[model samples]
Target: MRIAQVCNVGEICGGTAACAWSITLAFPDVDHTVIFLSPPNSRTVEAFQHCQFHSAKSITDGMIRHLNVDLVILHNSTPNRVAQIRSTPSIQYHHSMGSRTAADVHLACSKWLHQRTPQSTQVLWQPTPIPIQRTDNPSRNAATSLRIGRICTPDDRKWPQSLIPLYERLAESFKNVEWEFIGAPGTLRESLQHACRGNARFITADVSARSRYWSWHALLYHHPTISESFGRTVAESMRCGTVPIVDRKGGFCEQIESGKNGFLCTNPDDFVAAIHQIQDRNHLSQLSQRAQDSSHEKCSLSIFRSRFLRILNQLSLGDSFDA
Candidate 1:
């Protein structure tokens, strides 16, 4: 089927952009096109090489009509363009649905969003692929210090001032532990530099993704947002065999099995406690394996593609009706 995905392909490698990346690469068989709402960049152009790329402003309904497109998927749409179209099957594939309730079809990224969406809105669970393959055995060097990785938006929610005390304590108590944070605000960057001024304990990186999760023991993902719509990075880390110590609330609870696959922290204290729980290499290694196992079993690429194809088949069978 001919399909078009409209999204804001920003420079920052966010969950939405990552989801789009996964979709394009996984479904190359379909006549898929990405209509980027934002200014196109080399990064996005290269990423969507398999699919046709177009700017949203340049793309008219006539073009979609000309292509005989069957479906239009909206990603993070604030003011949906789907409302203008009456002939095509438009689905709001939501990362955040905002205030709108009435839509032809609403596909949620997580169960949390599905539960929160209007009952009248047709909600379906569409899990995001980790964009990486799972490793059977996670790597760990017993001779070196523990490596803890964190990738966040640099907001107060992700890198809160509240956690400053805990950071100080962790830096002081565990000299063997090294914290690696990526994408932080200038204030946070300066503060972290000051905090770790005496030693080389905290390191900041500017890379696409740390592929060394296989070597890392755990990923600390504690955000003040209470619950995320979906924890994409946490799942990504898990796919690389790195256990995530995530928050207990929201969509994070859906991703982690709590102690089995990964640890779920309640607060900063709980986060500290969770770290204490990881004492030896054996426990860390086992949790790492379980993390990858859970990711492979729960959020594999095959499952995503299969479920997506099944949805399309149902739609083709005239099962897609406005809720």
Candidate 2:
């Protein structure tokens, strides 16, 4: 079956774009096309060369009219595009496109997201593809330093802002732990860097935070201030067998069973307690194994293919896959 994946951002490597690209790579049998609304990044444009691409500055009526595909999957599409393609046999593959979006089917990445979305939505687990080249040792390498990491996006929406004081207290209290922030410079990073001004323990590297998942023994992402449509980074770290310390909110809460595969925190106090719980190497090792195992069970390629086909079957567009 011919499938078209539509997205707004093409240049930035955010979760939306990442999910769209992953779909293209996952399905080789089904004819796939990427319809990008914004000016696509050169790297991504080249990557999608194996398939077809239609990049435009705006989502126009002509662009909508030209998509001759059996199924249209909207992955982070603009409202205009959503409206333009409302008539097509389409489903929205979204993380945070809230209610009011009209579609034949709506696939949200997290249960919380699905719950908030219009009744048409269903939970669809996202799959992350292996990077083209092996990224820097994703696994923790330093024996002395208890490496901790999280994305410091420009907006500082990744984690709870209310936990800043507690985070500062911990950073100062623990000498052996290293904190790594891998996004645009933000106020929180600045504060953490200021609080830990004496040494390199407070690291602010502009690196692919996702690639460094394995390097971090644990991800402290408690108190997600903004409602996450899907917590891709949480699962990414879990896939690397890295335990995540996340709040009891968003999509992360759906995949995680507190004290089982990962730690689920209620607030800053609970978050700090959870961190201490996995301080022991043996205990941390057990959680890590379970995290990776859970990732494999929920987000593996085979499972992704199965879900993709199932959705197609529901649409009555089932074309057998070589997957």
Candidate 3:
């Protein structure tokens, strides 16, 4: 089957662009074309070399018809624009929070997001594919020093206003704890530097890279200000066997089972309590393994491929939708 994925492929890694790529890569047999709304950089061009790329400022029914694909997948498009397409069978793949498209069939990246979508809308759960494989054990040196880390883009909206206060509290509670912030910008790093007082290290790391999670015992994430539609980074960390202690909000709650695979915190004190529980080596190991297993079971590439193919079959793409 031929499919066209329309999305904004900006410089930032892993968002709608990554989701579109994952869906395309899932079906090797299907012909896929990516219609990037923004002009993609050289990195994006090299990364998505498997599929044909097209640059366009806006999407229209005429443009989609020109592609002559069996199906079209819309990502990060305006509601009115999404509703305007009438000739082609299209599906809106919602990736960001507060982004609702006017498509007949909607696919949300997490159960949390699926719930938030209007009950009237036909929304299906299509989780973001987390393609991480861990050959090594996820156990860490928790007895000596606890490595708490978080990975995200340098978006101020994702960071809580009370982040500095929360960091100070955590530093005071644990004597041997160190915090690492990956993908932090200079402005965010400056603020964290003042609060951490030499206890934190800010690194401008790639968001899609798995090596960033290796040294971390726990992914301590709290984004109370702006919730994620799908916590891709949190799930990725768990795939690497790093337990996530994230705020009990947004899609992060769906990825973690709370005290089983990982911990879900509501407040600063809750985060502290969760960290204290993982201080025990045995407990940490158990949670780490379970986190890895749960992540693989939930967001593995195989499951994503099956779900995507199933969606296409449901749409009556063709009789050869079996995979």
The whole-model lDDT of each prediction reads 0.65, 0.69, 0.74
Q: Which order, best to worst by lDDT?
A: 3, 2, 1
**Candidate 2 lDDT by residue in tens digits, 1-323:** 77887777774356776777677767867788887877776756766777788877555445556776777887755565446464457787767754334567778777777676665446788886543224455347455667877664434455445656766766666756777766534555556665544332433432243567767788877554565667777777788878988778777778888898898777667777777877888889899999889888887667887887888787777655553
Colliding pairs, model 2:
138-214, 138-215, 139-214, 160-223
- lDDT of each residue in 80-114, candidate 3, tens digit only: 44445677777877765555556546777777777
**Segments in model 2 whose C-alpha atoms lie over 4 Å from true places:** 42-51, 60-62, 84-88, 97-101, 130-142, 152-163, 186-188, 197-209
Q: TM-scores for all candidates?
A: 0.83, 0.85, 0.88
Instruction: Please provide, for model 1 over 73-103, each residue's C-alpha lDDT reduced to its tens digit, 9 standing for 90 to 100.
Output: 7676554443334467666677764653233
The alpha-carbon lDDT assigned to residue 72 of candidate 1 equals 73
Worst 10 residues of 3 by lDDT: 119-128
Regarding TM-score, does 1 or 3 come out ahead? 3
Candidate 1, residue 48: CA error in Å? 1.9
Instruction: Name the better of 2 and 3 by TM-score.
Output: 3
Candidate ranking (TM-score, best to worst):
3, 2, 1
